[model samples]
Target: MNGTRLRPATFKYIESELYAYPDYQREINKIRDEIINGQEEQDENIGAGKNSYRKPGRPTERTVTRLDDNKRMNHLKEMVHVVEQVYDRLDDTQKKMIQLRYWSKRGANWEYIAEECFISRRTAFNYRKEIVGAIASKLGMN
Candidate 1:
């Protein structure tokens, strides 16, 4: 729970990622919607068959490869998934800890988080370690 198993940089990266989780989720949803819209347009054009041979319904290898190579989208999805996995495994108090530490508008400190959760400051820190370590391990950062 100390996050000692992860490299210092990785630990920091995971922390930043957790803090950015909401933004990342929004971006992911926006990207997905864009892709869907673009696909629909492409399907309409493909139905006309002016540039033929790609078929009307099937996606081409190039299209699939391009989607697979979208590093930003893939990374966002992975980060969101890892966070969700760790969050789901946490109890209500730990969930509250994450919400306080990462999602609070006022950027609550350990003391405030401990007070809100009815735990000691040390316990709040420990919850952070457990959550961060879980995320790092899920991300193969250990």
Candidate 2:
């Protein structure tokens, strides 16, 4: 039995997506229209031969692989969107800290984050933890 648990009653699906706001609406459109629209176009006949690549007579292993890839991509895109939403929700400093600590190519060290945030390394580390925890909670992974 673990004492550390996320707070209760955080589900808010019906609410508007912060990622779909006017500022980032294009990103949402890309995900919804491109990925899902193509998914619908290809997924119409999953069991039949006419699928994915539109090959005839029993969709082959490649078609199945394509479908699986589409599904995985869709899920990954959704996860990215959710994380983007959480990123938007975080405070400005928190956002900067998170980006510096994670989104950077080499992944900035805590000292860098501390300097950027004008705080101690320990505080910077705590901010990163808090920001990441919020994202994980929003994605329903925590």
The RMSD of every model to the true structure, in order and in angstroms, is 4.5, 10.7
Supply the global lDDT for candidate 2: 0.55
For each candidate in turn, the TM-score is: 0.76, 0.51
Which candidate leads the pack in lDDT? Answer: 1
10 residues in a row with least lDDT, candidate 1: 37-46
Cα-based lDDT for every prediction: 0.79, 0.55
Per-residue error at 101 for model 2, in Å? Answer: 1.7
Candidate 2 residue 49 C-alpha distance from true site, Å: 16
Worst 10 residues of 2 by lDDT: 11-20
The segments of candidate 1 whose C-alpha lies over 4 angstroms from its true place after superposition are 1-4, 38-65
